[model samples]
Target: MSIKMMPYLILDGNGAEAVAFYVKALGAEVMALQTFGGMPQSPDQPVPDEAKDRVANAQLSIGGAEFMLSDNYPGMAYQLGDQVSVCIITNSKEDSEALFNALADEGTIHMAFQETFWSPGYGIVTDKFGVNFQISTEA
Candidate 1:
């Protein structure tokens, strides 16, 4: 089987909320969303009610690429230094604007999506998860 590197973003503890944000901003289609508290495989694991809905794993598709997101596992200490970000590329003007507007809500919009010499409908933002995203539709 061929292996692929899917972008996995780790959020502090707001993964579910972050996923919702992405849905609006990127117009992403959610393929799967699971939480540690809801996983049958790990039923015995202790989970607080608050973390039950936190994203254990979420699969989303944008710009024809598969992307993944999750929250830090409880009790697993992490510091989350800035290292990488997943970029999304759109194919149409409508798709670009739809995604840009969606993502801009509840998050910081670094740049607004618009047509430019570099590309048509391109913008940048860092979702509430602190994961940077670049949205663009090719010229």
Candidate 2:
């Protein structure tokens, strides 16, 4: 048996916004979204209206890649860190163009997603939520 390692992000109650941003930026598909706010609760502990829509988990896909997100845990700080990032290697020039544009719309492009001397196509951007990403396509 083999196990695949997918990057997981723990947002500070910003999973939904991050997911929406990724959908636009990476053309990522929402594979699944589990929210504590949307689940049935016990009569003793009813789901709070404020938290009902808060995401418990979300799975997003870009091409064959996937990542997970969550907003259920509280008291967690999401300040920028250099611990993790998703490096996306695009499948085609079109994919690279569209995703790079979308990600750059409201985020910082660390290194412009353009042709590099070493690679055919490449770019780097930090999404709106401060998640760093690397995008590239073959020549």
Best by lDDT: 1
RMSD of each: 14.5, 14.6
lDDT of 1 by residue, 1-139 (tens): 1123456687878888888999999899999998877765444756777777778768899989888878876666557674245656666778777776787778888678777554777786777767677676756
- lDDT (C-alpha, whole model) for all candidates: 0.73, 0.72
What are the per-residue Cα lDDT tens digits for candidate 2 across 86-127?
Answer: 755555767776777798888988788678643577786888
Best by TM-score: 1
Backbone collisions counted per model: 4, 2
Q: Cα deviation of 54 in candidate 2 (Å)?
A: 1.0
